[model samples]
Target: MPRLKKTVFFAALITFATLLSIFCKMENRSNAELVKTDFDQQLASFQDAIEKKLLKAVLQRNEKEIKQSFLQTRAKYKRLEYYIEYFFPSTSALLNGAPIDEIELGENLIEQPTGFQVMEGIIYEQPTKENRAELLNEVKKMQLNLQRMSRFNEQYQITDAQLFDAMRLEIFRITSLGITGFDTPDALQSIPETASALRGIADVIAIYEPASTDKTVSSAIAYLDKQPNFNNFDRLTFITDYLDPISKYISSLRLARKIPTVASGSALHDDAISMFQTNAFNVDKFVGNSTQFINNDKVALGKALFNDAVLSNGANRSCTSCHHQSLAFTDGLSKATGISKGEPLLRNTPTLTYAGLQRGFFYDLKAGTLEDQALDVVHQKQEMNGSLTQAAAKINSSKTYFSLFQKAYEDKSGKADAWKIQHALASYIRSLAPFNSRFDRYMRGDKKQLNADEKKGFNLFMGKAKCGSCHFAPLFNGTQAPLFSKSEAEVLGVPSTTDTIKPKIDQDLGRYALYAYPQYKYSFKTSTLRNIKKTAPYMHNGVYKNLTQVMDFYNRGGGIGLGIPVENQTLSADRLNLSKLEIEQIIAFLGTLDDLP
Candidate 1:
């Protein structure tokens, strides 16, 4: 009887414990759902406010009202940028991408710029009665975008892991785009907008992991609040001290919670606390799995092939003939002499310093990759003038070349081919990525790296000067922020010479020769500004002889500002009106981009 009673009591206790466990799990799930619902409600509220303001601004056609409302809408978007950018990237870009339109070589349709940026440009450019109709249309597009986002939120589930990852990526976005003023170029409200975005992240984090909220989060907010005027704010200090620490803390919390990220491959690693961290930019980020053949042996073989004149038809010119390391990989000429040694080449020789990081190659962006670029250069009539077949046969005839190719390709069979040679050359070129510029060192918390003038120059570059809008941060190239996937081409309308009195637009036609599109009439790939001092004779035609001349051209607003009749100049025709001192400051900042030892 006693044994039976004891067993019955123990069974009852076990049953109660199991029921309690189930109930707790049910409660936790309900809480999660509630949190998600609350977040959705907040997003809906913000979107509704934006819609209301946009409609009001469109109807009134008041420029001041429109600008104010647009800024409000952008702030709200920034608040939810992390969530929307992660889940609905396409829709998000449609809502607020840059005002530039992009079209590929063979694509029939152009990826026209739509959204806030478009509207911003239209309204900010003149804000007159002429743009009222266009502004209204843009507002309608934004409304549709809001609807799309709402639908996405309604259907998609938000996981804790995703939230964590989204927050980290948001931190990266703030570092790359927010601080650099890439998005809000016209108004220069990056500093304030960044604070709002950070607050949004904190709010979301608090909802997901209430107990994990710590002093670091509040400290970041406080630091942002304490920032000075946009021009005077020390971006280097803010990023290194507050932002980096906050990012590290958040990453630590995520790891401690054992949260599984939704997508680990593309997401920022925990060690990447700041944009200037040694491992911040992945060397292989641009190189996809399909074409990653870089190794020491291959690079060695590539170096040999690059210097060898056997690849050229005349055996008198090599890759190094035009791209010498001493001159920052450029031939230091207005235009390079071809192997024929007849007339100058059509376009200027671009530097190979950061060429590997760029998606599109050459001034016209004809080649899609470094490999394609190498082959094209070798086979071009005016360039190497060498057929791949002939070059390959010549190389295979030599025992040393055959052995080097085998070692490079990891083929014991000892074969030499055109593809392998191109790959080797491309590998050598790609190995020239220089990330150790003085600017890089400064960003990595080395205060002594930049003097007061250089720091001020950096601020101007990112702010009022509007250089960062195109050059971008970190790489300081057209490789777009956060992802750094594709390079951007701009129709700057470069002239034939620096004769501002009688400037004539260069007749190259740039990418138009390939695409035959009017929009691509004067389009040229935006090259890396790295080592600009060394790679002078600026522009696609190398028209500007010095940096000062180039700055003067830009200050006057490219070819259009020089009174050259270029209808589709992508660069704004309005003069930058930069003072001589400001120009000097900018040059000082640019000097820090030199990566030479």
Candidate 2:
């Protein structure tokens, strides 16, 4: 009896020891560390595939094999992009940024394009001997980029907060940029790539999520699985039912876990909230040198100058002459009139509200900053028709203006010069950022703010209507969501008139006139949809008189569907085929964007 009791005691002790050891091991390997390990392995595999498959296919001049390899390479990259893009932005840009020359901020140096997009443009087109050399060079560059990312993954440490933030932003990125075919413009593989990206995110989330959250992940995958093709994909249903819910669940988990905000200098900052969140977007993010321009005194002085007719050459019209506050800062004319009656301006007067959020200014995107934009408007031939130099002199001529300028620029050593005048005007415009709209309020947890029809409209705008893909969320502007780094321009192929008879592509050669890029022909800066209800006579040319007309044009697939010859139309020629009810719902949502008094 004594020997049997001793044996039982020893056996129980051994079992306890083994269980404790396993617990210790599990505790040591955190979810974040495990996620990193998984990410590293995927990235390494992608790099290997690129070298073995992509490089060889390109060099051998095997078009069929090259296409197949490129698809695989792109898919692998998309899977890892959620982490890579957030942690190492410059490398990601080198790997997959648009094949266009982009001027660096502050430095004003233009960066020549490289990587996947550059290669896509080359390999997808008819490959010539000359193009083959370019393709080889681009492939080598991509290999180098991959090596850089691999090195970054080795040293970079990711926290739980960053992982959650990255996952959410990835959803936003896929929703806004991915499904819209923004990156894979030629291949049109956005749908498949998006599915791959979502799966990648799901795999990572599954590592940490509890059993209760499993349904969210499964539902998202189910939605993606149900889609027969890219065209048939119900974007609205996916956003409303799956993506948004999953994001919310993850966000809740993040909060419940008490995870810290993402570290600064990463792709997303701690303050960077999702687009769906109300009162979260900071307008100062868009304001270049915000500290220099965001002063209250500056805004006040700018408001005074905005209403001062002396800013115009004839002194008969101020900024308010074309932009009335009553009409949501729009003139309500088809095209703005010059100081001299009967003389029309170059384009319709776009609203000042949320205009400052855009990276580029004007229909042609000629102005790089709001200060430059203000200067251009001041000196335009038929608009303000006043030089900044003359405007400064005129402002100084008045005692009231002199005192206001003195107050506004009190911190500056120099007097109110043309530069200060431009800055002040830009400051006032920047203050009009869209943060207090009905939609914004609703998003901030006011459940009763949006009605059933309005909510449906919101879904349609984001989903089937394809508006959110271009307009984007939160700001509902061209400034890309998650990171409002740059605004985008689209070639909608808008016609001169809504006339069905002998429809003609507008003669205005939009951004093409500015930079002369073949791709930019008929391309106009994507403007804000905020206050669309009030800002009538839409489009740069003001061809569409109402929202219904505009919706119908988009439903019919812009100029291409109208039987107009627009070879360079950036908007997809695929008809949206939205019903009347859907169109009305979208319009109702647009109404919610209007700022309350």
Candidate 3:
């Protein structure tokens, strides 16, 4: 009996010890997970800072702050790879009852919706090599977007700031933070806080009053009629011209490059910031900070710099020389001359009027975003004849330019690149978006109604003429779709009214050149019909001189003259042919699109 009792006691002790050991291991793991969660929360704080910087730069044109902020922000992207490395294994361990360090392998990665993946789409951490490609693409996108927004924010003030914040936060949440990788049902779901912030950004920016920023300049502009020696410039022209004189600088005769020796950032004082605060305690200071976006002095500097030969390679032409506002972005020519050769540019210079309505830019549609376009144009031998390296060197040399860059891009480095200048130009172009056209007013029902002629013209446009199918409305640039729509090109049979034989089909295939698709022979991007009357000699080749003449050609299912026989013509042939007065009405309606916002 004594022997039996002793053996039972030993067995019990062994059982108890084993169970205790298991429990201790489990407790330690739980604590580690808690630490991870805390770390993740801290990471989120840094992420938010990046989002704010990117958004502020894009929307508010806070070039200076946004510049450094963006560089720092993008530089942090490489660090995000750790997210996948750290979190995925832990998440898997929790779900599968494995050790926390056990890695989640193979296809257990995140996926964004088709368009939102990679460069243009959502971002994610932790992935297979395939998934890493997507993340890399997204990083590139952030880099591009940061640069572009940095440039463009200057044109629009406080309201634009709000918009930028919303866009940045929304993008960050969807790409960087959202559950784009897990098989969990709600992995892709957005956090409530982030979602709410996005709505708030839009609402705030929408209500921002631009008057605050331009109040000083507006006063000056209003008083311009009362000023003396004003006869040298027109009323509208003079107010526009005011930008150049205020920000004065010297340009080089041959290269037109800006040479700056000093630098200063504009009025960023605490009291001034407080003054911009609205009636409510709006924390973002959306209203109060509105004026921070613009500096008449900087704008004036930028404006004069735009026309000055000092910035150009050859010094013979300026941005205005190519993009004639009077001619509506186009120089009234299919292609313009550069310093290189008399040979025409590869494509027609489209109007700057409504160019801002787009996400991706350029006729080729190769640029993923606006900043890409801005940067490319400067570097192109046929374009601005400037390099980012050279631009930064030249601008940093200028004392005033350094200050302008600091105010605009927040650094001497920002001035070093062409981004700040390009974005400023883009903002100016975007501001050219005027939506108050007579036809637009009639459509919105602000006016009584379109007359019978215009009504008939509208019907024809929507109906037989079928112009709106490609040349869509509201923006009238390309087809109207939700966000991220591809720019469309058409193979219009535009025979040279100037010459007999039409240009070869392969010669002017717009998108085909980009994609090298044989199908898109002779296709060209559908330009905004807004201000079409102002830009004459239509088509990619400037084949037609007037709307009536172009319409007549389209009426015949492309040129009756010699050309690659019009196959796959968008316009139907010989069907709903129109009368003369009908043509006049349609022309009148098109004319309505001419007066830009």
Which candidate achieves the best TM-score against the true structure?
Answer: 1
Which window of 10 residues has the lowest lDDT sum in candidate 2? 264-273
Candidate 1 wrongly placed segments (more than 4 Å): 1-27, 30-39, 60-64, 125-130, 212-217, 226-228, 260-271
> Of models 1 and 2, which has the larger TM-score?
1
Clash totals in order: 0, 0, 39
How far in Å is the alpha carbon of 521 misplaced in model 3? 2.5
lDDT of 1 at 129: 68
The sequence of per-residue lDDT tens digits that candidate 1 reaches over residues 366-417 is: 8887888889989988899887778888888889987887877778867777
Write model 3 residue lDDT over 32-133, tens digit each, in one string: 243334334534554565556655543444445544554444323322322222223222122211111111124543332221222112222333456445
Instruction: Score residue 454 of candidate 1 by CA lDDT.
Output: 88
Kindly indicate the candidate among 1 and 3 with the higher TM-score.
Answer: 1
Candidate 2 accuracy as TM-score = 0.77
Per-residue accuracy of model 2 over 1-597 as CA lDDT, tens digit each:
699998999999999999999889877988898899888888889988888998899889999988899989999999988888888888888999877776554674678888888888887889899998898898898888888778867887778888887887887787667776667766767777877888788778778773454678677776676773655566655765677777777777778778776643322335444556554555565566645547788899999989988788878878998899988899898999986778887799999998877788888878888989888888887887888887777666677777787788774333567888888999899888757888877766676788878988876676566777788776777878667787888888899988877788998899888666676789898899999999999999898899999999999988998889888786868788899998998899899999888
lDDT, residue 497, candidate 1 = 74
TM-score, one value per model:
0.90, 0.77, 0.48
Model 2, residue 200: what's the lDDT?
A: 85
Show the colliding residue pairs in model 2: none
lDDT of all predictions: 0.79, 0.80, 0.46
User: Model 3: residues >4 Å from true position, as ranges?
Assistant: 1-305, 340-342, 410-416, 448-452, 482-484, 496-506, 559-563, 566-576
